[model samples]
Target: MLLLLLLPSALLLVPWAGAGRIIGGWEAQPHSRPYMAHLLIRNASHKFECGGFLIRPDAVLSAAHCVTGKKAVNTTVILGAHNLKKKEPSWQVFHVGHWVIHPNYSKDKKENDIMLLKLKPRAKLTKEVSYISLPRHNEQVKPNTTCKVAGWGWTSTTGDETSVLMEVDLKVLSEKVCENRFQKKYLHQSMICAGDEEGKKSTSRGDSGGPLVCNGKAHGVVSYGPKYCVFPKIFTRVSYFEPWIHEELRKFVLQDLPDSPSSD
Candidate 1:
């Protein structure tokens, strides 16, 4: 039996995952997370509120909620960026051609929190820009396995977003532990749990829609986190959605993607 969440909870989706980087993390190298791509809006109030990763030459993986109601034409994806506040030669921006959010994604339940963006002009694979490797279908990460999560999220829970990209290491916890600690009903099996109880590391404000890499393969997507970034973070299990990703990407790039030397 599952208990209904009767509390007046807005379910604050923290924008960043790195605790001032996921609490006790550090700044990552410029090209460490090469696949990392920050999302921006077209308006003058353009903000790097969300994060993403390049899974293919013309496709980017992100959270469905990031573009749920927004116009796809106004969105842009920036890649090879080490710092958002500084101009770097490695950074390149591209317009979004199409938005492919998961069909079953729900705003209320936060289920299937994944989406894919098609770039207008395919990105050129370079030393500072490349695609991340996705894991095989249905692969499950064992408990206590340390994985890497990087983003331009806030440096602290209540702080502003980080100017430089931040990367942090988190240990994967079993689904049962996450359910028991939080609301059992809300924690879906398609989600992965990873965090530190010591309040040392966590995903903070504006770190959503980033990748969670384990054993050198992207296996999770930063979907949500606890209030104020104090508890373990919840990520959409990438392995569980492998089929959706492959299907969506195949629609764009049917031919084989050229192999390029990655510096990440």
Candidate 2:
């Protein structure tokens, strides 16, 4: 009777709750391909990892949440390598000089989810530690365009975390489809959507703040996803935030580039 009805409802709710945790936390399948570098944050006692890009010799751009609301500045940015669990002497470990989280960053809405880290010493640009080009201002990528996303986050809906960098091909979707899928939650002008319609390849939990690069240029930063970790990955559009990025870069130049002109 009533007990049977309630039991069925409880069973139905179990999967939803578990799905929420899997999609919301740092857990997923392992990816096969690697394309991005991740910055591992380790304090004296605790250790946490996040994704980032070597945008310059002296600066690494990542999500603000990755730096702020964390432990002391014993952070190390691992460059040129992906497998964190392995011991690779070739990978560089940089001491963090300073970090700047976007002033307008909102944890609830995830607005302005960008951050910049200054290394104690400048890293040399080579075949491995090269900088990725940022998108130009006013550049608008149309829907259905193919793009690539890479990170060291989880791979599948129920898989182990990845030690090596993982990359997947994604397709940009229309804002309308994104809004409908996510119910317009945190989907704004500064963000765009990408992924497969059938939940093929997409960003999952712990993939936040990674690069959604397209056309050899970084176009978005991983932001949010849907209930089942399916398609339609919401990404913060880099082009819309070009001005802020330039301003931040200028600040870095002023601090790091003593010989260069202040106007840079």
User: How well does each candidate superpose onto the true structure, as a TM-score?
Assistant: 0.84, 0.79
Candidate 2 least-lDDT 10 residues: 13-22
Distance from true position, residue 216, model 2, in Å? 0.5
Cα error, residue 162 of model 2, in Å, equals 2.9
Model 1 / residue 222 / CA error / Å:
0.4
lDDT of candidate 2 over 181-203, digit per residue (tens) = 55535455787877766655666
lDDT of candidate 1 over 1-264, digit per residue (tens): 122123224445432333223446789977978899988755445444678899888888988877775543478789999988997988889877577889999876668989998875788899999999988888988889999888775666556556888888888977765676556434555888887756577766566788889998888888876454456677888888999888877766643356643211
Task: Please give the CA lDDT of all the candidate structures.
Answer: 0.74, 0.64
Show where candidate 1 strays beyond 4 Å: 1-22, 42-48, 71-73, 186-188, 254-264
True-structure lDDT of candidate 2: 0.64
